[model samples]
Target: EAKASYWRQLAMDEIRRRSEYQPNTRRARNIIFFLGDGMGISTVTAGRIYRGQRRDGSSGEEGCLSWDRFPHVSLHKTYGLDAQTSDSANTATAYLCGVKANVKTIGVDSRIKAGQCHTDKSTHVSSIMAWAQTEGLWTGLVTTTSVTHASPAGTYAHVGHRGWEGYVPNNCMVNDTKDSARQLVEESPGNEFRVILGGGRMNFINNTENDEEGLKGNRRDGRNLIEQWMKSKEGKSNASYIWSKEQLLSVDPSTTNYLLGLLGSTRLPFVMEQDKNCSSYPTLREMTEVAIKILQRGPKGFVLFVEGGLIDYAHHANRAAFALEETVGMDDAVISAMKLVDTKESLILVSADHSHAFTIGGKPERGKDILGIGGYSTDGYPITTLSYANGPGYNETKVNYTDAETTDPNFVQKATFRRYLATHGGEDIATYAIGPWSHLFSGVQDQTYIPYAISYAACFGQFAGSNCHTCKTSTG
Candidate 1:
């Protein structure tokens, strides 16, 4: 018994030490921030239980690697300066720049005059990625969404509103035409980020043009950002541009200092839709691995932002099964990242930008079926084991419906939709960090401080307040 106690103490000591472990000042070389877009505690909890049920016969313990394994964990308030239920643009701006800005604004605070309305200017501010790039550190941005989408765009681009895409600009005068979506993706090139990956081919394509097949489809920007990017000095000598999985794996990492990979014209296929012969697409994990390999080649330490950006979309569609699978895929990406970089010298932070209104509540039998049996009852009624609070095509009655039965085709579980009163936990979202200044994240913290916390950890807190003061001791 005494020997067993000694081993347990040793394990506890090791865990505690891991939490407090600081990186060597001289050797520390990289910072990787992984954002799970809408992963709330319940979302993560449901994911764990789902994976556990699939693996072993029982729902695993509350503590799992994604939740329990990080050295330090904290909660974050996700409200934007203007709204309560935040969007990715504002939340991402806060995470990337450390300030609470107006909703739909990217990479800027809400003080600038944007045409008629008082909106933030993307030019006045600097993003962490920009800072890293200025310091000569190689940076990479990867997401399942468009490269210019909110989260990914926050890493580098700055704009008054996130909706600059889709709509045609009202004014076409030379000076007034700058706000057009086409120019937003390419022509405006001050903050040219080294590594760019993801979808949004539509933004780059011209409105009228035909491809080799003579199909008069929208040709990506006549400028051809992909071709220009590939032919540039960075793309030609230091980087390899790949639009498919085959090109991604075949590229020589040692010689490639930069890589431009866009798997799909839109968001990449969800995990369920992807398979081994997914030659045209790359999984989140695969992109992460390749990004790390290339970024590490830089002499200065690098900053890489990877997003499981699709989780939120699944929740929006009320597809819990798809959301859970995406979360698992995110976990796989985290594991792959940890494998390549040593915790001793790297700072790794895993967190969410905001959360979904999803929850897990159903008393399924201990070893019972996942797709429950015996006419499942919540309070007391025939219902499916899974449900959503509020979303499109939602209905409290019928408990089961098909596309033909519902008004919306995007609806996942139409009939099973019992409108439970859903709410985001007033409790801040969870944050996990390892290595260097991870200690800063212990206990509950405001959401806006995350970027500062990361910057401090990566640079040993040296550049804490130079420009990014939103995360300093005052904010905390």
Candidate 2:
């Protein structure tokens, strides 16, 4: 219980803070889009509370996340053009390309269908990264998931199927369509990128080849695309390719204009599972800051896409602790970006592709351990505060976690129904923004509005207006 003075003072402080806040009116020269895959409003609330508890053992419910200070906030519908509940591919296409696409499709419009091998090339859609690059702006991407994964793939790859990342079917897709990794190496926006940092190097190397870690490659096309990417940069720019954390930090951002960092064979290990082997893996914060340091050198500024993609993975696996930690990890990158960039000249947008069936309920008291049990069930079994709608944790009988180590990374929370993996939730996601034109993001808008609003602020795509900089319009 709190007193009247406490409530009044808290309200006054918040009101005073709001009154003093003023948005920057100038058009943004730099655009940084941060995507937290599967991070819904529930995830945000849990992560904020979890972070607060971890930081100071506070009640956590009243605390704010790093991005909570952003002056503009909104809610957006997350359904795809063809899906009542969307996956990463379609949702990424919506936010990144400003087009609602079918599930399992990336960088293409509704004219493309899932698993369709061949389609008219005109159906291909371009993302903000392309629009920025065509305007002579530096472009880059960073993520904790595979660079070939659906979220990042939307920025570069135009494939009928996201699984085409490493292997294009031998079927009749016009016989010469390259895989996603090859596109990143040899094609448009991806090739023109100033920085590329993420996992999935197995897709880049030949099946016969091995990386420095002795991990076998997955590419059956016999192309070492990493080497090809390096060769393509020959005599064009001071490009450097790295496969380890030490290599990433050793390269000087002042001299290296193009950087490709493949940090993991697949997705990077979860934070809790990371072996103090800092030399092997790089945090999302490290990759983002490094990318910003190099990309910020451009005279015309830059557009960067940074993703905390593993949150979705953890949620599907029914690991609530890891999901919440990954959410906070994204906020860590946001905090770093806020410190590194000039908000007056940079527009920072933080949002999610969709949500999970994860929930945080049960009248757990204030300061209760977020990962611990909430209360006992009527049957006399203790249940955790966190649970899922459907996942591997489901059983005919509820399992008791009363004496279990709920904090363990391997611990899976209970679910109401059985599913090998949980599915995405069909719900609106919260969107946060700041910098110029961020107010346009207020209120409920379609997910496709993300790139549109960004384009308006950065002066690219269809919103470039009459005095456009590019000879040809890249997108709108």
Candidate 3:
């Protein structure tokens, strides 16, 4: 028992050291912005509740960290400039660029093109990534989605249209020379982002050759971007680009000055799929850990953006189980990150671009047979099996449906659920932040306040103020 106690104490000390809040030792230079891509307040709440219920047959709140624990918290109005309901492109531009843009815009502002009515180009703008690059800080981007997707694009590229993925529609742009998607992935050189890991092999490769394997397309650019990145080293710096899990783990972290790992052809496989094939694929947490290790080499501190990009896709598909699992997976990444950097100098901000149409309301007992048929109250009442507001797979049924064949026959059929409500919640979504000046987020504020809050708190951002300034400057 004494020996066991000593070892346990040593382990606890090590964990505490990893998760320490060392403000003074911190460089006050590095920033990590983690985005849970379509994770609305409800999704988070449900995820927490589901995980909690699974653990102890209690509300999800019991099993996880609450966003309220952050020193600062704020809300953002997620509507696009042109539309009330916003997409990732518009929202990412707002949060990343500090400008509210029209729907489908990446990192550009709205300025009508000369002599062209209804046509415009975004004015001078720079993403936090670009700013960090200019500041000579090591930068990196990690995501579970295609790196060229809208959310990640906001970090590196600026384009008028979001869907300019290599192939451009005729009416979109005049230049047929440059592929927007390719530019989005490779343009980060100006920022000197040492590590770029995610999906979207198609964006990097040419439209002439087939990708590695499991994908059907000629997307390999004749010039390998990985090799180019490796060769463009400064002084003794070197880079190693890996596409497979085996390659990623085998690379020498001490020798590799820069690392580019693009695991999948598009967005990575969902968490469940990855878990089943864990031996061959790195999980999101693993990717984040490796990126952090590589980026920490720069003494000026670093800027890293790690995204749980698949949560949005799962929510869009109305796959609540998959979405919740993804959220948990994202949480694991966050936990891993927290173990890496001290809370004082490093700023960790976790937020979502917008809310989802998801909800959580039912009297279902904890662990009370998720796959079972609904039952009536002893006082004589009807119960719901599953519920949704609006989506393609909803079927209105007066009777309970429990059989595997009736409940979910196929992927498309599995999406269908009974309606318990007709509307989404009007409540604001939640934001979480810690480290450095995380005290800036405490109460409710607009979505626009998020970027400024993080920037001002971190002592960065050329453009500060609007809602965050009001919160930080005001005493109330």
Candidate 4:
């Protein structure tokens, strides 16, 4: 009776919160789009429950994430232009450029082939960052993956192949075409970015110059792009290039014009692997805070993209704890970012580029450890709550999970078949939105709708008109 009363009161509170909600129809002055790469609905549910269980000692089912409070929510189709299951490059292109492209292609429409160098120039598509830049709005990008990785590259760089971040493939001999690194540093008006924080330092520096962590640069052309970017910003005030957390925190946003921070040598450290007391990198939440502080300095407002990319890496490895922890890290960043912006002037959208074929089954009692193993199967094998459709976890021989450390950071859940890496799922992914024109996100929409929605809400790109209050006031 007491439990029933508690649940009833919770439901009533949710109802009241919903009843009090009033949609803000104002033009968005800023847009903070958070992409949790490979975070599916199942991943969110498991991460929510796991985080709640670990942080609050609660049952976890009732706990709400920062995005859970978003006023509008919708499911988006994640398939590529040609394939039912999408890759990060295709999905990133879809949502960032508002055009669906073939797998492994970035910042180009469907006509471009994945690795054909000649077609790259003709099929190029402009991203929201380019549109935002044209309208005099400051723009930035942050991610747990390499800054040159598919999702982040989608914002500013165009390439035939996503892997051509620093160097072109061995077989492809296109001397005229520059790599994603060159595009970001030289072609995209790199010095104009208000804030660019994330990983992939090796792609920007030369082979002789080591990264902050003593990691060798991978650029074959021997161009130190970071040095080039710094040279361009020489006359610009408050232009700083940072590689450490201490330097990042010391910068004054009020006095800063451009800030480029590469927080990791490659991809940022996973939340589980990061040694908080000794690590050189900043957490995702810290990076988001610094970015918001810097970008909000512009009088014209800004557009920032934050990606929780480690979630996908963990999922690919079939590491449930790592994936869930990464999601929790992303949630923390989202919560921090939400507090920094006003809903009246900012539109925040949270979604995933794609999903992994992960599942949570073998229903244990409520409040049970989400990472713990479920009861024994009918075949007398203990199964975990988290398992993949196919992965490195597949074993030919039966194994006992009764005493295995399933919750360990390195633990990989059991799988039905063996594969080099767990594959992406084809199901619809959820997109949560709030602030100006968020209502347009209602109902199932194509992934392409996101970039359009952002462009429209901010009154940029093809949607620029009298309805865009910020645009009209700033331009006039």
- Estimate, for each residue in 1-476, the C-alpha lDDT of model 3 and write its tens digit: 24898879978986786577443322246788889887887777667765665545764444664443455566767776777777788778888878787777777666622112223333635777776665567888898887778888778766666665444555444543234455643455332668888887766565665567656432433544444555555464676667877887787766677777778787888875654635576778888888888887777788888889988876666566667778878888888888887777788888888776665544666544332334554655444333345555465544444445333312222223444322223346567877766756667776667767655654455532242333355356
Q: How far is candidate 1 from the true structure (C-alpha RMSD, Å)?
A: 5.8
Q: Which portions of model 2 miss their true places by more than 4 Å?
A: 277-279, 465-476
lDDT digits (tens) for residues 299-362 of candidate 4: 8889999999999999888888999999999999999998999988899999999989999999
Clashing pairs in 1: 204-220, 204-221, 205-219, 205-220, 205-221, 206-219, 238-257, 399-415, 400-415
- lDDT measured at residue 396 in model 4 versus the true structure, 0 to 100: 88
Candidate 2 lDDT, 152-243, residue by residue in tens = 99899899888988888888446687778988988998999999999998999988999978999999878899999999999977899898
What is candidate 3's local distance difference test score?
A: 0.66
In order, what lDDT does every prediction score?
0.66, 0.88, 0.66, 0.87
Summing lDDT over every window of 10 consecutive residues in candidate 4, give the lowest-scoring window.
467-476
Each candidate structure's TM-score, on Cα atoms with residue i matched to residue i, is: 0.81, 0.95, 0.79, 0.95
Per-residue error for 11 in candidate 1, Å, reads 10
List clash counts for every candidate, in order: 9, 2, 16, 0
The regions of model 3 sitting more than 4 angstroms off are 1-27, 54-61, 66-69, 112-124, 170-177, 185-191, 218-236, 275-279, 366-386, 396-399, 403-427, 463-476
